[model samples]
Target: MSSLRAYRQIVRRPSRKIYVGPVAVGGDAPISVQTMTNTLTTDVDGTLDQIRRSAAAGADIVRVSCPDEDSTKALKDIVAGSPVPIVADIHFHYRRAIEAAEAGAACLRINPGNIGSEDRVREVIKAAKDYGCSMRIGVNAGSLERDLLEQYGEPCPDAMVESARRHMRILEDNDFTNFKISVKASDVFLAVAAYQALADACDYPLHLGITEAGGLRGGTVKSSVGLGMLLWSGIGDTIRVSLSADPVEEVRVGYEILKSLDLRHRGVRVVSCPSCARQGFDVVKTVATLEERLAHIEEPISLSVIGCIVNGPGEARETDVGLTGGGGGSHMVYLAGNQDHKIGTEAMVDHLVALVEKKAAVLAAERAAARAAADEPK
Candidate 1:
């Protein structure tokens, strides 16, 4: 146990623990993926539907903007119906934070600088403490305090770090330590630098993201670059890929980042070749179809869709399942690095999906058996 603890310490920063519903954040917990709903919070059914979708997409925590009375009032239904924990994003309104707490929010996201006065900040903290809810002091470059901007001329990395420290001080002064912090900037360099500075300055678990990261393609790349750097350096404890697209896409990107680092595995990882002149199949369309079909799958498996048989079998060795094209519209299937059989090109996708489903079922059963064995007698 001591050795295991030491290993964890070596891999991640040490920070106090906080719970958002049943999921743990900070020390020793697997880094979690989070996303915010774009739906109007007052639309309880719509918001709850988005929440359930985000949870199904493997979001460990979901946040909704609580900017008004209606949104706050709707929190009860959202929280009660959500599959995962909900965090209320309260800006400039301490009352909403209080209401969200009363309505069973698992966490409250508050920016102390914007929440009216010091007294208001304290009141929000008190509400959080009373309800046993965690808080996130989100410091965005777009909304840093004026004094810091005047002192630094812009929302530089230092200014962002200072802003986070200020909000953190407010929570600390109120003896409210059940909180995490995020210092986000639109610029990837600034966001990464600010997080690095904060990580050195304190032990609080860092919530990592590059805010307003454009649309699906642009935002995914931007977030992957920024969050990827922080996560690789062992700085982030929880992450949100702030894309201006469906919230579910954000959760998908978060897991991809974690999966790429071998830190966490929550879905199928499709590996395909870029296709060259020697290629034999329509690898592009096949890969797209496979990805679309496997988007919502939660099982962790590697599937390689190669274009030709020449280099395919060798590449397939690293994957759980694979397909390599044969001559004249035929294909060879490989399962767990072995040649399974041959099939027609038209039937390849369905065949691969069936093989994957079978493997996923067996994997699930093995996990259940192992868990049952562990819980039994010893």
Candidate 2:
């Protein structure tokens, strides 16, 4: 049997805390969720729309590529309009990094070593400092330094860590330390190993990800397995689930990964069983419909939807709201783990939605009152 203690608690790694805008990452701060925009940076409105939706979906930070002058020029507006902190993605251009900083970016995602001469590197670092921006040293296995590739003969964990250290040295040598690092790879094994090695190598915040992790479904699984291993080990601080799907999906999946480990809680968490022959209701369709209906809820809630009494009541007893298939076209509804009432199959979805919304309102009011009490001149 799996150890319940292991599932309930994780001893996170000790690391220096840093800020991506006002959002704290690493050390004792809550693990942050991040995603990147797929829209063109020049399309400020479109990018801001995506960013707004992502923030609404629970993205604490968002990255947008700055490949040219126009993107950096547009960065001014994007930064002004974004609901969450923006990290300018500067793959290789030192100038772009500087521009992004001046444009009010909260962070700049770049490898300092790749920014050319020490003087040029200092310029970008200076810009970051002047603009009150942090930085991210992103090292990908597919883009390892040629020298390291020749030295290690492959993109192994050691190679990736070495690459990170090289870039880290540039920042540290310049007396810059407000930064996090990521050693990502497309392969799960490679990404996990590199992250593990890097985690122990430095006290810098680790930005976890499986870079280029395929489509929505495939990427979610690959990232879950890869990120899950690291997060379970308490190695990640801020995370972005790289997916070829919509950026909002990335935020959603990132939250799901974090939610699975109980690292962070946001939105409704549905617990459903796969439909079996004994089922009296359409378990699959019901669960999906409820998920969409409850997507707007940001408050944490546990809901179970099982097809029959076999395991339904058992699961229902642990959730905030639950539904179990019953006889004569009526199904059981559980509220706060108690048998509340029954509903017909035709009206089940709407009824559950109403119950969840009401529960959410109650929780929100309770939270507000607590916050108000805490601020009562204590």
Candidate 3:
């Protein structure tokens, strides 16, 4: 049997906190969720639209690529319109990095090794300081520096860490200290191992990711496994779940990973069973529909929709609201664990949605009152 002790706790690693705009990362800050906009940076409206959607999905920070002069020029408008802090992604072009900072980017994503001469790096660092922007030293297994690749014969954990240190040294040598690092790879083992090694080797905030994982389903699973290992061991500070689908999906997946580990909670977490022959209703369809309907509820709550009485009541006992199917056309409803009432199959979806919305409103008001009370000059 799995150890019960594993469920009780996770002591996060201690690292210096840094601000990516107003959002705090590392130290005691809540682990933040991030996603990158795939829309062309020069298409300011399109990029801002995507950023808004990602933010609505609970993204704390968003990254936009600035590959040329036009993209950097557009950064001014995108940053101005974005609801969350924007990180300008620049590769091999120090001019774009400098321009992005002056354009009001909260952070700059650049691999120092790829940005050319030391003088250029110092200039970029100077720009970051002038604009009060933090930086992300992103080192990927697929894009390790040429010298490090030749040194290790391939992209391995050691090589990725070496690449990260090289970049860190560049910033430190230039007296730049406000930065986080990510050593990412699509290979789960490589990414996990590299992150673990990187976490141990530095006190700087670590940005966790499994780069270029895949599409929605495949990428979610791969990132969960890789990020799960690191998070369970108390390693990650901020996270981005790399997916090829909509940028919103990346933010959703990142929150789900954090939710599963009890590190953070944002929206409704549904605990439903995989329908079996003994199921009382269409378990799979019900869950799919409920997730879509409940997406608008931002407050964290748990709801279990079990098919039959086998494990239904037991699972429901642990959730805020629950439903367990019965032999008749109706099913039992659970509120705060105990059986509250029953409802026919036809009314199940609508009834559950109403109950969840009501519960969310009550919780939100309670939180507001608590905040108000705490603010009293006591």
Candidate 4:
């Protein structure tokens, strides 16, 4: 009886459109995926190379930390060489925000409260406007303002939302509307509740994230629970899965979240059944190997790996391509839901990967042909 029908009824809030370089972040635009760079921003070439890798991995926007003048100065080169839009992460330094804007960053992310006076915030805003860059006010529980902490006794959801409101009001008062907001907490519940409150308060697009979300496994779960709730409620505009691992992993997790929600499609989606007593062969290892090989493939395709013949065919029937384990060290290979042939278990992984590559080529060609036909006049 579980359904997505009622979830579809949630109305998305209206917000003004803003561009972070070439990617649109709000106002009916597709929810964007972002990741920050772990490379020292001062290493211009290394940073640019990582940015390219992130863009190639399906990241929509990239953020670089500008912790000092050296990194701030290197922003110009990084921005010039970056394949995707770049945002500068500034903390407790208004001048660095100004420097990053002038260096051609698409956006500047700063915590207004931590960056000092109202005048300093305005100075950063003025620089952002001058450079035609947007701003993101990132409010995290670990860094909430002292007064708000004293008033609320903790960095709770209400306190976080209040901090966001205060920063937002300052920017709005300066007539700066080209900005987004993020209120992040390590606690999943706190993060979700803070976003819900902000969604009800204003239409400024939200950059969803759970701050300090642990390593790959823990971070993925925390971010999914918090961001999934907000996205399901039509509350997030952009997302970053803050993992302690490589920044590229963050981009991958972001896309996976969007893919699960049916909001964005990128790379292949694999469906594999857990092996049971009825399983005929080693389905787990086969599926894992295939997944590793296809990690970088961006074309959207579905592949199912089932353990037993009983429910395998029926389940695989719905996928683009599939494999079902059988006896005698052999397996059934399915293409477009039809049993094509039987192959030995040792060769199954390679065969399926080759089949997928062949199918991907055909799909790519068909898409190109369609595009070429569309360009031709009647």
Q: For candidate 1, give the lDDT of residue 280.
A: 71
lDDT of 2 by residue, 196-282 (tens): 999989999999999999999999999999999999998999999999999999999999989899999999999999999999899
RMSD of 3: 1.8
Clashes of 4: 0
RMSD of each: 3.1, 1.5, 1.8, 2.4
TM-score of 2: 0.98
Per-model CA lDDT versus the true structure:
0.89, 0.95, 0.94, 0.88
Candidate 3's TM-score reads 0.97
Per-residue accuracy of model 3 over 163-268 as CA lDDT, tens digit each: 8998999999888989999999999999999999998899999999999999999999999999999999999899999999999999989988999999998889
lDDT of 3: 0.94
- In candidate 4, which residue ranges exceed 4 Å CA deviation? 1-11, 369-378
Highest lDDT scorer: 2
* Native-structure RMSD, model 1: 3.1
What tens digits encode model 1's per-residue C-alpha lDDT throughout 1-378?
A: 798555544266788778888899998899999999999988999998888888898999999999899988989988999889999998887899999999999999888878888888888888888898999999999998999999999889899898888888888988988889999999999999999999999998888889999999999999999988888778889999998899999999899989987789877998898988767778998899988888767779999999897789997888999888778888888888999889898788888888888888888899899999999995
User: What TM-score would every model get versus the actual structure?
Assistant: 0.95, 0.98, 0.97, 0.93
Q: Per the 3 Å backbone cut-off, how many clashing residue pairs does candidate 2 have?
A: 0
Q: In model 2, state the lDDT of residue 87.
A: 99
